[model samples]
Target: MAWKVELTETARKQLTRLDKTQAQRITKYLRRVMMLEDPRDAGKALTGNLRTYWRYRVGDYRVICEIRDAELVIVAVEIGHRSEVYG
Candidate 1:
């Protein structure tokens, strides 16, 4: 089943800091990939303290999210470049 996607307030701020094209690309990836498929197939599960979250790659950017299976929802927690996203 398709999942519902929501961007957290911090994630929204991060997206706004990206260039227009980059931001659009991330949004497209979220809608077309994350929302349409099982989130587990779209991104890898993060480890460490972030083990509950997943990371989706788009070019140089990464979209960090948490999947709630019971709700069929994908909540995007952050969006940023590869170098900065993990930190």
Candidate 2:
């Protein structure tokens, strides 16, 4: 089933602050893969206090999402570089 993808306000702001090329790359990846594919099949489940979220990697960045099964929406909670994303 195709899932709809959305970015939280924080995530949107974070994305805009990234380099133009990185932002474009992330947008393309979300549209092509996160939107079209089964989100659970492609993303890795997070752990610890963040266990409810799922994570998808695009190059050096990470996309942290919360999957809403009933609504069929994948909400991006945060987006950042590998070194700082989880913190």
Q: Which stretches of candidate 2 lie over 4 Å from their true place?
A: 35-37
Q: Write the per-residue lDDT of candidate 2 for residues 1-87, one digit (tens) a residue.
A: 777889999999999999999999999988876555577777899999999999999999999999998988999999999999999
The collision pairs in model 1 are none
Native-referenced Cα lDDT, model 1: 0.90
Q: What is residue 66's positional error in candidate 1, in angstroms? A: 0.3
lDDT of 1 by residue, 23-58 (tens): 999999888865565778878999999999999999
Task: Score candidate 2 by lDDT.
Answer: 0.91
Candidate RMSDs in order: 1.1, 1.2
The local distance difference test score of each candidate is: 0.90, 0.91
